[model samples]
Target: MAITSANQLELLQTAEAVAREKMIDPALVVEAMEESLARAAKSRYGSEMDIRVSIDRKTGRATFTRVRTVVEDEELENYQAEMTVEQAKQYMANPAVGDQFVEEVPPVDMGRIAAQSAKQVILQKVREAERDRQYEEFKDRAGTIINGVVKREEYGNVIVDVGRGEGILRRNEKIGRESYRPNDRIRCYIKDVRREARGPQIFLSRTAPEFMAELFKMEVPEIYDGIIEIKAVARDPGSRAKIAVISYDNSIDPVGACVGMRGSRVQAVVNELQGEKIDIIPWNEDVPTFLVNALQPAEVSKVVLDEDAERIEVVVPDEQLSLAIGRRGQNVRLASQLTGLDIDIMTEEEESKRRQAEFEERTKLFQAALDVDEFFAQLLVSEGFTNLEEVAYVEIEELTVIDGVDDDTATELQARARDVLEEQAQRALAHARELGADDSLIEFEGLTPQMLEALAEDGVKTLEDFATCADWELAGGWTTDNGQRVKDDGILEKFDVSLEEAQSMVMTARVLLGWVDPEELEQGNEDEIDEDAVEASEDEA
Candidate 1:
């Protein structure tokens, strides 16, 4: 009364039907049959025996057999044991010294045990094929948003049935405070699908930055058509997010389009994500402005970048400092991600104090050398101007206008300033000559003879010297032919010397001095030769 043979034919028919229905090849069934029958025979008979199993594809009927050799000596073993010549010749044609024989084995009954074995093989094949089919079905869906039912929640993980397979929504992957009941329909992003021993593993996430990107793709027509692009996204799920967006089309505003009318589109996404707030900012190539925009709803006074350290210090008003930092530093965190800067938020007062300290230090240095409050005075000294002659030729009126200098102090400092400017000019000329300028000064078109005299009086007697003068030095006192004064004009621009080229001129002058050979001074006409002394003779002539 064993049930093994009772439904053998019925089971075979069912396997065939399932294979055809699922598009699984029937050859696999035959393979399963062969494997099952071979195992069944091995179990019933000794494993040392050679077992052979074959199935007729058309009939689905399977046969199991064993092959054994014919040996003269009864003690000889093995399926192909040595046999007598007469016996070997009877089975093999032209039997020789190394020839063997093959005999067709009679089919076995495949009793209750074998039938049960075959049934198990069919079930395994069906399950494996189904798993493969499911993997193929879901792999193409990675990154797409899919609607699925939440089957259950266990230990903070929600198991969602995404049609062909189950996708796991881990604890962190769920939006904050978002609850799901069994059979609750929800939309989630397909993060990845991987093959596992049990089945195909599908990872679902509602917290991925791509979730926002995909949601935008669904709601914004511009983004869907590729006119507007979501350049980057930074999010704190169920709380806030910062997104940088750009548009390929000139007419389109990527942020505005994503927001929609009265924030309908973005709000729709927020609703889906359990009301997380979203900040959409315009992308910019400028790091400072981009950082400002990234830290939205919080006003930024300034962004000081520390390029070497890869950090940015953001200064905002004391009131906006907390806002810029956001709740638990979320705003700054998202902004940092968006702008790719390690941002440190500071109050305006803190930045002001830091700036004040730096100014005081520089002021101390300047005041230490000379009784002046002008930071530019320190800059002049750094440029090598230390005497009254150097200050006279180069303009110092502009220094008074900079932060922390007053008009009365500028007037008191004017003579000392002139001497310092002139000395800097002379030092600049010497430095330039050391860099290789042996020629007389190259007269720039606008510079008058009087200006040259004033520069010479300040000890700036050469082109090499003139080029060292800071631009702001020429911004005043030097009168145009129209009697108007040019202010902070870039002196290098007035002449044809690059600071490098000018330095070369100075170097050459220092090397040549008056000993400039004919070859060295071989550059101009007789009239130009007299150009350097022409000022002295102009009035007499």
Candidate 2:
């Protein structure tokens, strides 16, 4: 059967209805219909001829045309689709190249195969239009809440029917204690929206900490209006959670504000989380003060902070140690996470013992480094000289201030400490050379003896090996541990070579040896090095 002239208006009405049902612009359907008609009309009109169709929006009438553009003789790429201006002028007057002329073609009498092909084209276009519209609608909605009804479960993954689209909530995203059935209304956070070959997938989550934070934002007006704010949040799913908050207005209490009027606001969030306990603590600007608040219900008597290592040692009363650490260390772990520092909790007795051990270590170091008697060593250690570096670097006048130390004794102690350092450096260099370190590497200024030994073990025995070393290799963390080796994070973790110093050493070795050009390296050309960069290699050799 062929589609007759009487059915052309029906085609336009059908396209408009499908567009409305699919929630896409009707113009897309109209465009798809036009292409289908043009393809179907190809057999009647010549196959090589340019063909086009347009449907009137108001009257639902379709018109077909044979469109050919006028071109110069040299510009003729296709004889059937383009006509030379001389040929075009036979039909019209003063025609110029690049001008398009329309020739009327007969209406298409769409046969069974033609109508089937048009149907496939329309369906594909509508499906593609739906996916695009869905992507645009939900892409900006990520990290926000969306309400949907559970459609069904497939292999433990739940499908949801959001108002405008469908989404998937994987098993891992659901709270471990939560269960859902079909038609169950649920609120989920849109974690991501991805475009895939099948369709747009909107991924939802319920266990994300951001989801709980968002819930707080909705329940608390102070947070919403910026009176009080939530700083950080951590969750153990439905078991327990903690949130840190701070207030902008000095008179406002951040914790009281978050707890709400008789605990109304926080309770709403708690109910949603299935009775999970939440510790809402007031945030402090000082890390130590904030840490004290994070470890609520525990009393601290002492705090030793190591800012360089980002670690904190908190000393609690003996009876409070278990409470401070919490059941399974959860309390201290949460506090560490909230403070961004590694924390160690100990009782007062332990801290006292540790302090005594440190005193002995410092006293021994001074007695050996300065050739002092026991009483003098204790006097130096009590004055805060922990290592030989302090003894060698301190002013002779400052040393003379130590009780019973005369000017001559101070000068002799300083000279002896310096001599010991010089001897150590010489012995270290000799040991490195004996381990097969190349002369060129041995002469390098920045590398220490231990670094040379580490490199020698890895077969980087020559200056050329040092020059060819990547900045990462010099930066050190690449060794593996087995058998007698200890588990080390990186080579520099055991030594002291910083990445910046290693970078300088590698580049200087390469440039000084003429293995690379300073200007060539600067240009970053990698491929083109002028004669100068390469020519110096032999002279340095």
Candidate 3:
């Protein structure tokens, strides 16, 4: 092949044809041709020579050039491509260390081997450009639903021909046992788009919770218009699912709108999900109320929520227990997912028994700690005094309100509770000292004696050790491990040390040890407050 006048126009024609076939920019194809021609020219010319090619976009003309750069004397390595400053003076009146000298070169008459190599270079460039184009086209389409034709199945994975690109629906992402032959129509969620060595990968999913939400958005006009919002979704794909929705317009019932007239809208989504049964629930700002709605078809007798732990206890009638738990606990699992809480479901009888057990335990603690008889301890428990601290520090009027108890009796009860607490504290302090606790930690103003003993047992005995501890380490926290929330026990957690208190105590220790500047800490706190104030004002606005 030669870059003659007859073939010069052919180059641009071929570029246009290839660009049209690839659905890429014609300029990119032309650039690829230029690079391939340059590579061929380098083979014809000395390999050491810097050869370049340019194609005229308007006229389809090819221009070849030989380039040599001026360099410092010691930096000149390639004699054919680089020239020293002094040696470049022959071509110009004055040449600096960084100057390129270009001269026109004759086009290469490519042989069979050279032409084949050039063809490979152009193909590689075109493939890269096509990959880039596909990535750009579909990147923003993620988190959306797309219609595609199933191309084939590799192992359990399905490959779909999503116009202009290929999407992969992995086995785990498919609804249970979904099997498709070639050319089968499929609808899937664009879960992710990634650029990889082979090509841009468009991962599709049929089992994502978002897929069900998107389906509702498609089938429900109110959802698409933002009148109804899908607050949460949980799916056992191909089996059962739950969706919680809310309506901003008071006249619009979110659940009714999602269920549609005669269940038309939800039926459409259900049909697409391979007959997955869906329970549409109204979303409530109150978590317990929302949870009650989530576990539908089952009556809830009581709901006890531990907000800090993101856990909930639901008491249902014994007859409703099986319904609330579902077959194999699926109903409760989906409800938990929908509400983002760990649910402990029990029968009303079970909850009552547990309550009674707790009452008996509190009575026992009061009987032992305050030296009270069983009846007196039971009376104290009934008065809502669970621990000695409350009994010791509560107003005397609170105790006096109990039956057969006067001011004198209340005073005597508080005195005994305080004395017992003091003794317990002294014993805790002694045990902590035995565990090598220093006075620096014992005298820390906010920590109780029990906290000191816990810290010492956990190998954090000194003030220095406390200063090095993270706030979460002292106040306990929940961490996600393998997609499950695990509890991390904190040394001071039993002492009711909140995360904020732990942070403040640690900062105080750091300041006392000269490890952190008090002025800087104060300034940081002021800055945080100012930022918070700005955010609050913006939210109000």
Candidate 4:
């Protein structure tokens, strides 16, 4: 269809066809045409002149107008696009400032090049409109399962056509066991959708743990009805997966319900996952119990938990250790992910050997360090005094309560422990100072000698590094990477700073640095200082 024609119906029909083909509103196409015609008109009428074009929706006839705002003689900025009120009075009497005058000009018939330019403008505008439409259509669909037909494959990535737009299932997102040719139907999790310069990129994922959870939700009626809830899921993508489920109703067993009659329900989900094995376990609020359940087919004898550290030690029968850890540690690894805790597995024999070694070491430490006899050392070890620090820092009343230990002996023992720690602190301080640690840092209130040494050893000798250190950096356990777990402590862990205490210490350093006014922080900006003279203010903040 010709973009430029004397027949106005042809223009309207062309707009309708282009809008339908581009999946945009026909009115937007007409506006684009008006903009294009305005460009053509301005090219002939001088680019500096303010020219506008409007198209009739029904008749499709195009009209051009030259617009000028009437202003007082003193207010005119441009002579071509602005007119004085006295000059405007020729068209309308008593023209006032800010009044606009529009004069209709006859439509200029376009040549072939102008028509092509109009088509390009229309196509560009339609594409922009289609992108906006696709963004709005797919943005809310993130996390929902979308069904689409395979449109094509590029570099092993499947591009699916999902009616309103195309969705991309990146190669990494495809399940290991699945392959598709053109026109094959597939369902994928709408992992994310975003607008880009090329158009909307609707990303699909099949390997996401959420994708398996979504599949279970589709296959299990109880899960779909919200009676049984999926607490957490971890998948090795077509290899194996573990899901923790909980039922609100006491009469319904969550695991049995998820497994279905003779495993039919779970088998259906497994079929969809391309024969991936699934282990559905009951969820418990107690993490240890949940972890025990998470590691199925292997019996757990006992679980020793360190809640503050978010780590669990599970002891199983000697023969079950291999089974509990699974082949290549996959079972325990999935358990860690599903329970959100780091798991350390040991055989009963291994644990017994470890406990025996720890008992002997602690006894020896207490025997020599506290100058106590073997019997007294055993008593202290039995009382859970693992190190001299516990004996030094614990209350005198706690020490005196130990069997065969009087108040006087407890006091002497505590004094000896304190003396040992102090002597070690002095040696560490001397070493730190030799490493160029400043006196000001050593004298800082919250910092201890060991913390100072840890800083010095790491080349963080200045007050600036202390001020800039994060709570996690000081207390350790700061997650540096976005991986599933952290394997080591930060440098400040040697100083024994809790996360809360580390936060306080960092705040103290900031106050000492004068970066943040303490009063302003406490009052939440109720009062602020305009102290512009403070050096490095916010330059390092």
Candidate 5:
């Protein structure tokens, strides 16, 4: 039936009825009416039109008023177009060019266009208000499970009514192999709430990480109480899931608590997830160990990390390779996601081959570059001395204890190694001094000022000291105060430096000592020994 004046009154009453039924505030209807009327006037007459709308509390009817400006000029301003100065004088005397005027728009006939337009505006306003209400209702419930009645499926997405609003469970968010029927009461986590032109859009998810986290929360009170912290979670939705958990209190086992007695707690979650399996593993700060746990049912022998590449190579026994890798690599794939690493799974045989290749390469370098004999090389291999560092650093005493290596052999080998090391050290020192180490040399406790002076006189100013003296002479004795020649070892003890250190000192000392003539020393000895022999020869002549 056409809505007559009586029908309009009934419409207002019906609006009140619907508002009450929906638990919607009646005042919101009045506000919506005002807004709708204002919007209609603005749309029809432009916003420059000064219009105000008032709503009746009892009848819910709307009244409109138009405002104008009083002005001196007969030409009406936008706000004074409907009024004359004489009409505006009652409200404001001595009206100026910009003065405002007020009047009520005459009650127009209830034409189809105007009435229909107003009704449309009121309906739109009501919908907007309803949408806002729904948004507020659902926003606070985010991250919690809500039981929803399935409305329909559109484009593979399930539309569900969540009491006050409709939520969309997108196809991508639905668990694979899980089914639902219309009107089915399924529980979903409220992932988000958003306002739109039609209504509030509540987005739901069945595959979110929080879904599993919430399942644990429901089963384990400790999780809700904050005693346990869910460090990270990985899932395949309906198949299997891995959740890493930790407990603040040392006494509680997070995995055990989450599992519950006879698996009842976890079973409850599993049933809700449609018989999906769950592994509640304890979290560890150690990355390798955490990764091993993440790849459960698969035994991991060891995990080798390549930090720069952000990858980890996991070694599994030949028997467990398939288990560790899982069907179609799902196990290792989820583990990679959980541990945040690119995991490469390998069998013991493969890793052993890699280790063997590395060893062979190192051995080749030792044999080719270091001239290490087969016997000594085997000893180095057995002793874990794979690199040049071990050979260069092995002590003489320790080397002497090895079979076929006596004290003399050990000493000679140590001396050769020392020579190589000293040469390298001198070259480094020279480079360092070139790079500004002149002042830093003073910090060397091995080089005393007295020793430096002695070296200065012998023309042994720098590592260049090797240029003037033989290795044996530089490696030889130091002169004592009683004119006795003490060996380098004795001179080394004076400064608490080693023989190699004394050699470095001797290089410097040669410069300080300068060169003494051997011929002059021989003649001086003759002068002291045979002044009498000279006289006897003169007598014989």
Candidate 6:
């Protein structure tokens, strides 16, 4: 093979054909040909020589060149490709250290081995360009639905032929035991697009919650128009699913619109999902209300939410318990996922028993802490005074409002409660000091003596230790582990320390220890306030 006048136009013709076949830019194919020709030219010439090739896009002519760059005397390692400033004077009137001298060179007459190597190089370059083109084309298409034809199955994974690329649907991403044969048409969600050594990988999914949401979007015009929004979706793949939707337009009912006229719209989605049962619920800003709707077909007698823990307790009638929990707890699990909360469902009788137990426990605490009789402690408990702190610091009028309790009785009650609290505090302080608590921690304004004891027991004896602690470590929190909520116990949680209070106390400790700059903290707060104000104004608009 030679770059003769007869074959010069053939190179561009071949490049155009290859580019058309690969669906890539003709310029890229031409560039690949130039690179391959340069590689063959290097073999014909000295390997150290800097050989270059250029193809004229319009004329289809090949130009080969030898390039030698001027360099400092000590930097001229490549004798054929680099020239010292002084040696470069022979080639030009004046040449600087960074100048390059180019001379036209004869094209190579490639032998059988050289031509074969050049062909491989061109093929590699074309493949790389194709991969890049595919990656660029599909990267933005992620999180969307695509129609493809199933090509084959490797092990348990299904390979689909998308228009310009191949998508892989892993066994785990398939709905249930769905199987496909060659040339079977399939609809899937483009879960991800990645560039790899082999090629661009387009991962497809049929079990993604977003897939169901997208299906509804496709079937519902209101959703596509943004009149109705899919707020949340939870699915058990091909078995059961729940979707919560909200409507911005007051006239449009989100649930009804999603269900469509005579269940036609939802039915379309259901058919695509392989008969997956779906419960469409109206989205609500109130979490409990949304949860009640999520756990549909079950009558909720009462709802108790622990906001800080992100946990909810639902009391249903005994007959509805099984219905709320579903078969194998699937209903509650889907509801929890839909609402993003950990739900604990119980019967009304169970809730009553638990409440009675709590009441008895509070009465016991009051009786022991205040040195009051059972009836008096029960009365205090019934008045909503759960702890000695409330009884000690509450308004005199609040205690006086209790039956048979006058101002004098309230005053006596408060006196005794405060004395007991003081004694308990002193005992806690002594215990904390015994456990090697530092004065700096004990003197911290926000932490009570009991808090110090708890901290000392937890090995946080110094202000530095407190400063190093995260807010959740002192306030307790719920963490999602393996899709289940796990409780993290906090040392100060028993003292009813809220997350916000813990954050403030930790920040205060850090400031006192000079671990954080007060000015920077204040500036951050100001920035947050400004951002919040801007958001508030935007919401108002």
| Candidate with best TM-score | 3
Give candidate 5 regions above 4 Å deviation.
1-15, 21-23, 38-48, 58-62, 69-101, 371-541
lDDT accuracy of residue 262 in candidate 3 = 96
C-alpha lDDT (0 to 100) for residue 145 of candidate 1: 98
Q: Per-residue error at 237 for model 6, in Å?
A: 0.9
Q: lDDT of model 1 at residue 323? A: 87
* Per-residue lDDT value at 435 in model 1: 48
Model 3 per-residue lDDT tens digits across residues 170-260: 9999998979999999999999999999999999999999999999999999999999999999999999999999999999999999998
Each prediction's TM-score versus the true structure: 0.61, 0.84, 0.97, 0.86, 0.64, 0.96
lDDT per residue (tens digit) for residues 135-184 in model 1? 89899999999999999999989999887678999998988878899999
* Evaluation by TM-score, superior candidate among 3 and 6: 3
At residue 492, give the lDDT of candidate 3: 86
Superposed by TM-score, candidate 4 places the C-alpha of residue 235 at a distance from the truth, in angstroms, of: 0.7
Candidate order, TM-score descending: 3, 6, 4, 2, 5, 1
Q: Each prediction's Cα lDDT score?
A: 0.72, 0.82, 0.94, 0.86, 0.72, 0.94
lDDT of 4 by residue, 1-541 (tens): 2234467777789889988887888998888888988887777687877889988899887778999999879878888789998899898877889899999876776777777887788778888898998999899989989899999999989999998999999989988948899999998999999888899999999999999999889888888999999999998888899999999889999889888899988998898888889998989999889989999979999999988678899999999989999989989999999988888999999999999899999999988887878999998888888888999989999988987788998889989999989998998899899998998788898777887898999887878778888877777772436785664567788657788898887787888899989987777534333444243486667
lDDT of 2 by residue, 1-541 (tens): 3445577678778887998899899999998988888888886677888999888887777888988899889889877789999899888789998888898777877888888988788888889999999999999999899899999999889999998889999999888758899999999999999999998999999888888889988988878899888888877778778899998989988888878899998899888888888999888888888888888889998888877456799999999999999988888887887787778899999998998899888878777766778888888888888767677879888899988889888888888888877776677667777778888887777767666767776778778888887765666433335522222243333555666666777788989999888997787644445556677786798
Native-to-model Cα distance after best TM-score fit, residue 106 in candidate 5, in Å: 3.1
The residue-level lDDT of candidate 1 at 65 comes to: 64
Off by over 4 Å in 4: 1-6, 20-23, 70-98, 392-412, 418-469, 482-492, 509-516, 524-541
Worst 10 residues of 3 by lDDT: 489-498
Among residues 3 or more apart in sequence or in different chains, the pairs in candidate 2 whose N, CA or C atoms overlap within 3 Å are 477-490, 477-491
Per-residue lDDT over 1-541 for candidate 6, one digit per residue giving the tens place of the 0 to 100 score: 8889888889889999999999999999999888888999999998899999999998888999999999999887999999999999999888998899999998889999989998999999999999999999999999999999999999999999999999999999999998999999999999999999999999999999999999999999999999999999999999999999999999999999999889999999999999999999999999999999999988898899988778899999999999999999999999999998889999989998998999999999988877889999999888888888899899899999999999998899899988998998999999999999999999999889999999999999999999999999999888879867788998899888999899999999999999899999999999999999999999999
Q: How does model 4 fare in lDDT?
A: 0.86
Candidate 5 matches the true fold with a TM-score of 0.64
Candidate 1 residue spans exceeding 4 A from truth: 1-12, 20-30, 48-52, 63-104, 362-541
